[model samples]
Target: MTIPTARTTAPFDAVLCDLDDVIRLFDATEVTRLERAAGLPVGSTAASAFGPGRGGPLVLGQLSKDAWAESTARGLADRVPAARARELAAAFARAPFRTDPEVVELLRAARARCPVWIVTNGTPWLDEDLATLDLDGLADGIVNSARLGVAKPDPGILLHAAGRAGAAPERCLFVDDRAANVEAAAALGMATVHFRTAADLRPALAPLLARPVPHPRR
Candidate 1:
């Protein structure tokens, strides 16, 4: 979908972007393989780690990553050996989460034009994972939900990200793969791009970057 150019005269002051499925791509197949190797059913690992009352608290920063890992292991131990379960958890955590080189270049370009911040929902280990993907240095800042106690689709996190970028909510552009998140940001008066692919992203960001920066009042 085409993102319309900003109707206002002032260019966006910051760009807030999502991480998973946007900058870095997760491999579900690898996760499934790990689950099978651990003797758990397909999709079991996801259900145990990401379903309600499981990894949710971890993602919200209420539970420690170690605790979350232990919990996931326990859930898998019902079908596999405890040692195997723990191994599976560790392997999943260390899985190769890769970043799209094109997206990285785009992020760098966007940062040159305006402040860029990573606004993502993730556990405490997210920083470590981003570092592995060589994406930790691409943004001016990061607003992780685990540390902030809120996730996207909640306007609060989006506003918080704008604040971290030192920009008003209306002067920030939020890009995410989730429509719910894009809608939520739009509802809070932030310009949004529902990113799908590199093709969609380039056009969406073109007009924003082309607009002249707003001059400070004398």
Candidate 2:
């Protein structure tokens, strides 16, 4: 990766943001329907799908999405039939997600001042999802744990993200919905936004958003 030279003026030279629950939100309707049809509880699919034993390998790039789905199915084998469990797992795994427009706009505004990188613990299809959201190029770069064989709360991934953003950890603003991820970034000397609503980002990014983008000298 070609890391850019950090610009000195902005409060944050880079914005390292999370993807799931922060930018992309999943629709649980299909998963709910599948679980209900299989006589399972609403959160059962999610519980199995996201559990470390089943989902960890997928995020760490050790397992393919299909393999993860199969693992999740096996996790629910005692509760449902093999075929039904597989159906539920597949539906949950492939659940649709949408971008938070308000957050996207704010990030775009911040990008006018400095690079914005999506740093996330995500599956290999992460880029394809970004493309579906029309956000492929919204961020200057992306640091996907599935691609890197590491996940958040791990200092190495955060450091890799900061490097990709071309900023020292202290000069980057890390925004994530998870407190653990935020704390990890803070410990690395990066400013953090433990995001909840789009409003949570306004103040943290206000300094950069308020400034006008400078035109290149001809």
What clash count goes with each model? 0, 0
lDDT of 1 at 213: 51
* Model 1 lDDT tens row, 20-116: 8889986677777877766667877766677567666876888777777778777777888888788777666555667878878888777766789
lDDT of each: 0.80, 0.88
Measured with C-alpha atoms, the lDDT of residue 147 in candidate 2 is: 93
Model 2, C-alpha of 100: deviation from truth (Å): 0.8
User: At residue 160, what lDDT does model 1 achieve?
Assistant: 91
- Over 1-218, each residue of candidate 2 has an lDDT whose tens digit, in order, gives 99999666778789999989988889999889888888888899889987878667878878777888998998899999999999998888789889899998899877777889999998887777777787854788889999999998899999999998888999999999999999999999999999999999999999988788966312
Candidate 2: lDDT over CA atoms?
0.88
State the displacement of the C-alpha of residue 95, model 1, in Å, after optimal TM-score superposition: 1.5
TM-score of each: 0.80, 0.90
